[model samples]
Target: MTQLETAMAILMKTFDTYAAADGNKGSLSKGEAKTMLEKELPGLLKAAKNQAEVDKLLGGLDFNGDSEVDFSEFVVLVAALTCACHGRCKK
Candidate 1:
């Protein structure tokens, strides 16, 4: 599988772990992701140019435009960023 696929798998496993730990079940929603980022990775998201910029970036992964990105879609977005960052790191 590709790097993204692998990363996505890892992300799914992570969500599963979170669910298991919390006694909850099912995939994460877009709002949940935004909350998690705000609470857990505040520094990363604080760099966003503005709410619209952040929303646009989020929109790339919000395939359905429901204003909610599923865990799998979130994984894809994260993995894509990770890959890009890794590339820059290697340069």
Candidate 2:
């Protein structure tokens, strides 16, 4: 696979693990997913201005209106972020 594809695959794996463990990305308690993001995503996203913004961004993707972003939603959001960063791997 190409570099971008490989990056995306690794991202998907992270989402899968988070989903299987937490059910919904948003279901992750405050600082939980954020900590993971810090570790895994690194430069992928700008530092969220506040927890509210983080919640809002994640909430926007929670299609079911549940307070959690599911694996699919997380993937979609990460994909957007990847595109925003011009396909560069953040790690």
Candidate 3:
């Protein structure tokens, strides 16, 4: 697979791996989202100045107000972060 294809597959797999923890294979509950962020994006969490900032970030990701993050929402979060880090990661 191409690099983008592999990245997409990894995104799906990572989301599924976390979303399946509570038997909800389609979306992530708040706890699951927190766990996923804590484990998968520890640096991002650490960059937040406080717990409220991290909570706010996670809350903002739930665009539909459904209290759970679906795959599309998860993709938005990843895309936003990628954009935020785009130039910063360059050597």
Candidate 4:
């Protein structure tokens, strides 16, 4: 697979791995999302100014107000982070 394809597969795998933690394979609960962020995106959390900011960011993930983050919502977070990081790198 090409690099982008490989990345996409990894993203799906990562989401599935975390989303399955609570036996709900369909989406990630709030706890699952927090754990995923803390474990997989440690740097992002560390960069946050405070715990409240991290909480705010996590709260924002449930875009549909469904109290869970599905694959599409998760992808939006990943894409936004990727764009931010890429922009930072080019500076």
Give me the runs in candidate 4 sitting further than 4 Å from their true place.
88-91
TM-score of every model versus the real structure = 0.57, 0.58, 0.93, 0.93
**lDDT string, candidate 3, 24-75, tens digits:** 9999999999999999999998899999998998899899999999999999
lDDT of 2 by residue, 1-91 (tens): 9998998888777766655554453344334456557677665346676767766765676677765666666777767776777867553
lDDT score, candidate 2: 0.64
- Cα lDDT over the full model 1: 0.64
User: All models: lDDT?
Assistant: 0.64, 0.64, 0.94, 0.94
- Candidate 4: give its CA RMSD in angstroms: 2.5
Error of 2 at 49 (Å): 2.3
- Order candidates by TM-score, high to low: 3, 4, 2, 1
- The alpha-carbon deviation from the true structure for residue 87 of candidate 4, after best TM-score superposition, in angstroms, is 1.4
- Cα lDDT for residue 50, model 4? 100
